[model samples]
Target chain A: MKATILYEGKHQWTVFGRDPDKPEKIIDTNQYLVSTPSRALLIDPGGIEIFSSMLAATLHHVSVDQITDLFASHQDPDIISSLGLWDQVLPNARLHSPWLWESFIRHFGLNNIEYVPLPDDGGTIDLGDLSLQLVPAHYLHSSGNFNIYDPQAKILFSGDVGAALEADGAPMFVDDFDEHIPKMKMFHQRWMPSNRAKNDWVSRVRRLDVDILAPQHGRLYRGADVKRFLDWFEALEVGVGV
Target chain B: MARIKDERLAEGEVLVSVTVIAAELSEVMKIAKEISIGAKNAKAIAARAGDKARGFQPITNFIDDMARHTLTMVRQIDQEALSVSRICSQEIRTNDAKRRMHDVIRRVEHPSLLKSFQGVVTDIDARLIALRREFDKRLDHLAELLDSINSDMRAATAISSSCRVEASRAEEFREGLGVVADNLEQAVEVIKKHVKECSSRLQHAQRLKQAIYKK
Candidate 1:
């Protein structure tokens, strides 16, 4: 229901979430929008219910016409179900999503907007001034998953990779990493499917120079807390649902 | 009312639109059948009033013929509306199938299957558009038919007033026939009033269709 600018510069990074008004049974999602002067790319633009809220929130930061691209990390109602709604307003906008889920996500109603598929290996997305890397985080939770890494800002929009299922109105960033482990433990263990894939994603992301590890749900990990999350997640026995 | 405000109803909007139009057509069809029955009753009443009610006979017969024609047009519209509903339900079913097989479809490297999916989607869209245009044209035609029926009802009402005056000459023999002529006039007016209401609804539906699909 609100858009908070996490990073501000010529290229601004805004997080649209932390809704106290979100319905009881729905999972709260963090929709990340990276805005440039001429173009903007929205990552994981939430679902059908929060569409009006998302559009209203984004309008506070950038005009609806300014959003030139969209990225859906994977196909889940919570992640990208708003694709159908987006088709009406942003008819000219291009969708940067995993190629695997093109036909699947189309069932969510994607007739107007063009789909620019992200290869299985992942790739880079170009805004007018800045370009973000779409790194493959396959099987982190969804089979064809990705994490958007903004090298200039050192922020990794990690999709649901480090997501914690905390209550609504939770803090935007974790101050105490140890205290936050309980909120994320079950989500990572249960929702995340493969241990091999988890370790591979963690190891690969550890190599990145990340200042902020922003997940689609719960609070983000900032600076020192980013390393704390990686270290804790590395040893955590994930893929328990497997 | 607003032009595709929910945006999420993008393709699914066709289903909502068609359902609303079909329901309106059904209501109109029901009334058309009632009007037909009213005309049949009027014809029987006119036969009892022999020479005195002879003037009422031709007006009642015209009403009867118009009722039949109206019913035929209504039935035609209803069938087309039913087809739209059938198409919508079928699309919903096929879309569900596609969603379930998405992961399976990805695993299997069959280009033909993906092409077939695209083909199906395109065909459905085309069919929906054609059906909508047909509904729009029929709605216009129905409105025109209702106007003609209203005009005919007015003429019958005027003629019935004169017949009532003529029958009043033989108070003993044709007094009963005056009442029959009044009943026949009332039946025509009832049909005309209903047809006008139905015509107004059709106009509203046309406006709604424009808001949903037109740029």
Candidate 2:
């Protein structure tokens, strides 16, 4: 139940999961928390299986009342199936997600929450003083997905865009980018149906001043590795399944 | 009867039962606090009554020390309640995970996904039994704490009765110290009553805890 702080002071960001409470058979997921003094947001809060562990972990950082918003990149269970439990805790909290997933994600339970739908082109989530930008990331894997960008922190929460499926009890960050290719190659090729979407996303992110490229699954890409990830993804072929 | 579909213990029942036990323990804390106050008052009365209450002086210190011990034990019991709450919450999670396996088994069509689901369910079943065993061990620890508190009260009672008898030797001074001994006896009786009641309530909570170990 440790929330490892990525950035402290001013606007803070933390990465949670990869602990004993998370079972071995289940795929590893990285849950993010970005907070200022008055407001906080939970990114891809994870499935029902780890809800208590997540809540207990988050409480160590901030109380339930401080959580102002929840961000779901798209409607995937590993992404946000704990919405039902979250709804119980943060009944008045706003859920920020793509408009395409408004109806589909309701199946994860949205009775009390105010669903703030993001446009197809993506939009900004205002946390009072600090504003978070949602970068459009359609068909990287999910048909209508988006990525969270914190300009001040220079971190891009790339959703499933630069994801890798490391085995359970694996490293939190990429130690060897080239060696990690075999882990992510087949997953991307089969999951990302359109080669056009993959290239478009890679090209768009290259223009942004990103210091950290974080994803929902597997290790983060930091410093020069961010550029390395773009180069690899741009050259790789996806959706052929072969 | 078709075995009553939801025979499994509900989480809310465990929560409410724990809440009641915590409240009963609070009563014991309150009585311990009163006993401390009585000891302070008796010590003052002992000094004024002079040699007639000479034997009573040491016994007042005993009462004060016992009261302090009781308060410390109650704090430990509060910790026990917290441990029970944590274990109960874990049980709820195990139950939820088990139910989810059944859902996955029903809906997932892919052979790989279905096989994975089966593995998860098997893992969760083992986890549920382990959680119950852990819960039982915590309850046993809680029972030991209650027994320790009872032992402290009995020692305090033996000291208290000796002081009650000392109040009879005052002769001319007996007229004034009579009220003091009566107040001390009443405080002792109050402590005994609440401690006995709280011990029983804790045992009831422990039984309810035992009932929840069902598969």
Candidate 3:
């Protein structure tokens, strides 16, 4: 599956599926575009205030009716607050999220879409050549947390774990581990309190052989920086100096 | 011996003459007038003494009672003072805890940049609410204790004042007794001196009569 990376405003990265016979798909913090041979999926459409403009701009070349799925990682405002708005735009779309966070979602009062329950262990959802695996990140931050890993691209879409802050219009990819470590350390110290969960997450990610680490908040990491982050995360778990 | 008897008879005659002169109507009238004046002076002195004693007794008693009660009240005041001090210390401790809880709530409500995630907001809010409720309960308990203690202090103060007044009155009454005793002692000494002079005169007259009879 061919993919076109779109730089959605507000420091978000959207990977759009670029096949002629399929609709588009987006990912991460903002609107994402994923296209199969006959249908498409939009993951984590943002807040309702910006959804319409973002949808119009991002899907300028693609039709909204072709979008088939609206998937959310959890029930946080930044992640699934826009699902209600997306439900109005895409009538035929099914909303997929972990069952643990369903009650939290109902707070938004959205009722038109289907709520698909993802298993605890995780499973793969195939759209022709593109297969997205739902990796459980439970207890890392929230009970219903999960990460999406695209096997074909060797890209792990981390929800908040590997997130970092960047200036507006900054590069999306991490060019240096030395510069990123401070931001990552700050994030881990403030957000992730449980060392056991951090170690577990590190072990899980080490086995994946990920080439690209895409998080919702920060820049993506490629090559040795990803491995270095895992090592540092593991050291944090073991009470070793980084 | 005859000369001695004659001299003794002369002394006896003088003694008899003096006695007869005192027994005369005019002399008796004069003695009666002197006696009446003396009795009138004694009565006047006695009346003054009685007035002084009556005035002094209640004052002395009041002073003595006041002193005793004041002493007891002073002791109680010391105890209540200690209690007040203890209550103040406890109230300060409770207030400190309340301030610390407020600080904790403020800290949780506005977490650091790392916890700026959307999900952490809900957790912080819930925790802050719980902390605030706990702080409120503690403060309410402290306030109630303070109110009760304050009322107790006021009652203790009133009792302390009454005890002090009683103690003062007791001391005054005790001093009055000393003054009355001193005045009574002076009056008794004056009466004793007059009776001694009268007995000496009667003894002289008896000696003269014995000489005259022998002559």
Choose the strongest candidate by DockQ. 1
Q: Which residue pairs in model 2 clash with each other?
A: none
lDDT-better candidate, 2 vs 3: 2
For TM-score, candidate 2 versus 3, the one ahead is: 2
Candidate 1 on A1-242: residue-level lDDT in tens? 65678888889999989765577899999999999988889999998767656765666666656889999999999988878767755668899999999999998877679999889998899896798998899888889989999989999999987899987788788988888989999999999888799889889898999999999999988989999999888898887865
Q: Model 2: per-residue lDDT, tens digit, A1-242?
A: 44578777688999886857677677888899998888899999998777766765665566556888999999999999988767655668999999998999998877678999999998898999889889999998898899999889899999887788887667777888899888888878788888798888988898899988998888888889899989988888888895
Best by TM-score: 1
Best candidate (score: lDDT): 2
Q: Write model 3 residue lDDT over A69-166, tens digit each, in one string.
A: 77787777767776655544454678778888887886654656778877778786655556688888876666777787776567787777777655
For model 3 chain B, give the 10-residue run with minimal summed lDDT. B20-29
RMSD, every candidate, angstroms? 13.4, 18.3, 39.2
| Residues B1-215, model 2: lDDT tens digits | 11222424545566555556566778778878987888888788888877878987887888888889988988888788778777777677557756644544444334443432344456668867888888778777777877788788678767656765776776665644566556656655775676576566556655555554432
Return the TM-score for each candidate structure. 0.60, 0.55, 0.46
The DockQ for candidate 1, computed on C-alphas, is 0.03
Candidate 2 deviant stretches above 4 angstroms = B1-215
